[model samples]
Target: MAIPDGLDRIELTGLRGFGHHGVFDHERRDGQEFGVDVVLGLDLTAAGTTDDLAETVHYGELADSIHGVLVGPPVDLIETLALRMVDLCLTDARVQWASVTVHKPNAPITPTFTDVAVTIERSRR
Candidate 1:
């Protein structure tokens, strides 16, 4: 992973939530709350110096994109969904490395728990 200079982090959370996506049929049908936490590594020197969105990743746009994919279709797995979210964020100009964590709060697990989640990290090629 080639990390841009001085770009340590850009964290995005809340992102509303996703109601669908999972491997089981019931999971897809029932729909659940998916929490996403993202850490974006990039070169923020330019954006910081210039104070411009063009030089950095636009979090609002990224959130919108993630929300779209989460609710759009019947994805089979959270790994796949997380990977796609990583891909979605990397489509931008400023992102050099990205780490995505998606949490399914209302998972249909037999035992009640805080939440079920999958986390993935990827760097730009």
Candidate 2:
């Protein structure tokens, strides 16, 4: 199938996660397991035709880095965490656009729930 001249796709989902970040004190202190899914859109004209790894985005490395950020130093806000994740994607050379979702399953709320999540998308101008 022929994609557009300036668009490629990479999707990663069900990546196991951990984080101690939230507005509540318990959430910050106790930490929680989260899930992340991301889809990166960028130019793959050269890589797709040439079959070169260097010319494409390294999805494995990107996932690992995002995993690191989620489990790293405790932050107080999911918004900040989301932004940090976006920043990481923007640093990659091949990723011209991306969509990110962070899911919190063990959130410290009074009521029982399945999960809480946030999603954001960005692209170079």
Candidate 3:
């Protein structure tokens, strides 16, 4: 999604939440921790110049919203969860584009692995 140049970026990383999301039945029954990293593209000139809270997105509120989504519903795929988080970022008119990374650190793999994550990017069209 050709994001414009000079657009400032707001990054929120390592957001953790608990949810029941997986393909396996046992995974659904036993909840696990999920990590989210978000990058938002937006113009920060107004907020920078005016120093007004209303001029930019409130990160605290955004974090709460994302947390709610993480714990809200039981979705099987991390892809869907990532998309949901991207949607949340785009809710703000100021946000032009957003990228979300949903990390499933405790995925039910037979072999020991570090993590499994799904990332998605979306823009206002």
Better of 1 and 3 by TM-score: 3
Best-performing candidate as measured by lDDT: 3
Residues 1-125, model 3: lDDT tens digits = 54567788888899999999988898789899999988899999999999999999899999999999898789989999998889889989999989999999999888989999998999774
User: Best by TM-score, which number?
Assistant: 3
Worst 10 residues of 3 by lDDT: 1-10
Q: Pull out the clashing pairs in model 1.
A: none
TM-score of every model?
Answer: 0.86, 0.86, 0.94
lDDT per residue (tens digit) for residues 1-125 in model 1? 43455667888876656566877888777887777888899877888899987888888888888888777787877888889899888887668889888887777688869978888888764
Alpha carbon lDDT at 102, candidate 2 = 84
After superposing candidate 3 on the true structure, give the runs of residues whose Cα lies further than 4 Å from its correct spot. Answer: 1-3
Number of clashes found in candidate 1: 0
What is the TM-score ranking, best to worst?
A: 3, 1, 2
Model 2 residue 108 lDDT score: 70
